[model samples]
Target: MKPRIIMNFALIITLYSALTFYIGWNGWIWLHTAFGLQDKWIFGVILELISFSYIIGHFLKGIPFFKVIGAYWFGLLQYAILFLPLANLIALVLIYLNLPTTTIVKWVGAFVLAAFIVLFLYGSFNAYSPVVRKYSLAIPKNAGKLTKLRIAMASDMHFGRLSGISHARRLVREVNALKPDLILMPGDIIDDDPEPFIQKNFGDVMKDLSAPLGVFGVLGNHEYYGGGIPRYLTEMNRIGITILLDQVTNIADSFYLVGRKDKTDRDRMPIEDLLMNTEINLPIIMMDHQPAELKQAEKNHVDLLLSGHTHRGQMAPNHLITKRMFEVDWGYLKKNQLHTIVSSGFGFWGPPLRIGSRSEIIQIDVTFV
Candidate 1:
């Protein structure tokens, strides 16, 4: 592992461990005082077990049954991590006012547990079910002979324990239901673990996706993090999904579609280089993963840019991070002739949950003026 990766993992593990410990301590106190539960140590052990399972799950992707169990546990851990803080804060407020903490603790504990249960349950279903987010863009009058084009696009379908063949089938079904002339995937198709995809035979279902103009995709950060670019490329190719790494193609005799590799590539080609040989007069629709470098795309006279990676914060308060990080984190942004659409993503990366953002597929109705 790279030093940076090792350091990041160490930092995450340390922080997660601290949070787990805090929640367990507070929870035990609540159980002991409010409900007279004598098994505080047992509860602590259970929390430890859950944490361990999550930590090891990252390494157990190749394992069969353990991976599934670990994944579910990891999902639970994600919810707990978020809920515990709020629960603890509530207890703190009661104590701060010098009120009766024991009674309040019970109410807080019960409320936290119930709320998390509902949140995770809803999030699971939500993550599995993606809604179509449609947009309409007009091609400049100077470009293209094609009058109208229907493009169905999605991104961040992190296929693994949380999202596998079943989720893949649903997305493919929805995309096909749209009867689009073209299909585009911005990136993060595979999660960090590619083993689960192999175990689930996800490609078999994905192969059924129908787009007459063909399905094309760019590389996402996860594609490199997942550690199997060639394997993913081969699998996508087997399913007839074209993986375009900083390449441009003209389709439908009307527009140019350009796909760029994720910024993870240290030597990634620039937009200028990718479009250098292409006909600039045609309407160019670019699919780049992170949504950075808009000026470059605009400079190259890119008519439309489709991207996904942010997941629009995926959870509350996190959206604040993405909003500040990217120039166009979510939704549509147009500057003169250059247009951009960034999807919150069709699937999730972790927790199998979305607290603030909705998973979405972009149904773009492009009219060549």
Candidate 2:
């Protein structure tokens, strides 16, 4: 790595360590004072393990328990970092007011625990209960004999350990029930690893996803991160879902379905280059993982653009950041002739919790006039 890259990585490590220490220190204080927990060494060891479990999980991929702890920790870590300081401040105020330290600690701990429990329950519900987001539009172009097209698009399924067979079954059942003519998965079909997906036999559940126009997906950044493109492709292909990699296909000579490699791909073909040989008259529906370069799609005359990858922050206040980052983080955006619909995602990453955004599948009804 270059010197700057090394410096940045070191900085990140230092910050993460400092934050972990702060959280650990606060947690220790709470436990010791509130519950009279005397075992500091045991507590310290457990805290260290839990705090860095995800990083350790990366090294020890065979042990999924660490990964699970790490994932949940990551989710808790954010909220803990956000609220712990406030909790500490509240404790400080109680002290200033001459309230009993033990009483204050106990109450504060109880409140925080209750808050987390509620958040977990609510967030889990949002993560699991997917709703169909419907969109209807018309294009002044013809798609051969096809009058209307019902497209079922889902992105960031992140099928893995957390989002296991049950989630896959739900997705299959839901999408199949929609009876869409075509199914498009914009990206993140797997969650950073194809091992869990393949090992757990998720494809069996996913294979039940039915669409007459066939199921198509593209690589998300996670898929790229997993470095299992060949394995993922083979499995998807076997299950009858085509994983498009910077390729375009003519759908029954009616319209074009263009799939681009994730934006992470440095060599990903430009929109203009991808559409170079395509007929200008036919309606073109494109899928790119991240919702970047909206103008390019519009400029290239893409009739519709489908994407996911944003997860719309997946959690609250985070969506605020995502909104500023992307032109259309989640939902519809129309620029000239291009219609873009970005799904919050069917499956989630990390915590399987969604506070701001609900897990969703996009049902787009397009009529070619």
- CA lDDT of every candidate: 0.84, 0.92
- Candidate 1's C-alpha runs over 4 A off are 1-14, 34-36, 64-102, 141-145
Scored by TM-score, the top model is: 2
Tens digit of per-residue lDDT, candidate 1, span 1-369: 899999999999899788778767877877888778897678887878766775566666554454555556656666677778777777888889998877788888888878878887787777777889889888864544578889999999998777767789898899999999999999999886566676689989888889889999999999999788988888889989999988888786777889898999998898888888887788899999999988898899999999999999886668899999999999999988899999999888766778778888899998877
Q: On a 0 to 1 TM-score scale, where does candidate 2 land against the true structure?
A: 0.98
Error of 1 at 88 (Å): 4.4
- The candidate that wins on lDDT is 2
lDDT of 1 at 74: 55
Clashing pairs in 1: none
- Which RMSD values do the candidates have, in order? 2.9, 1.0
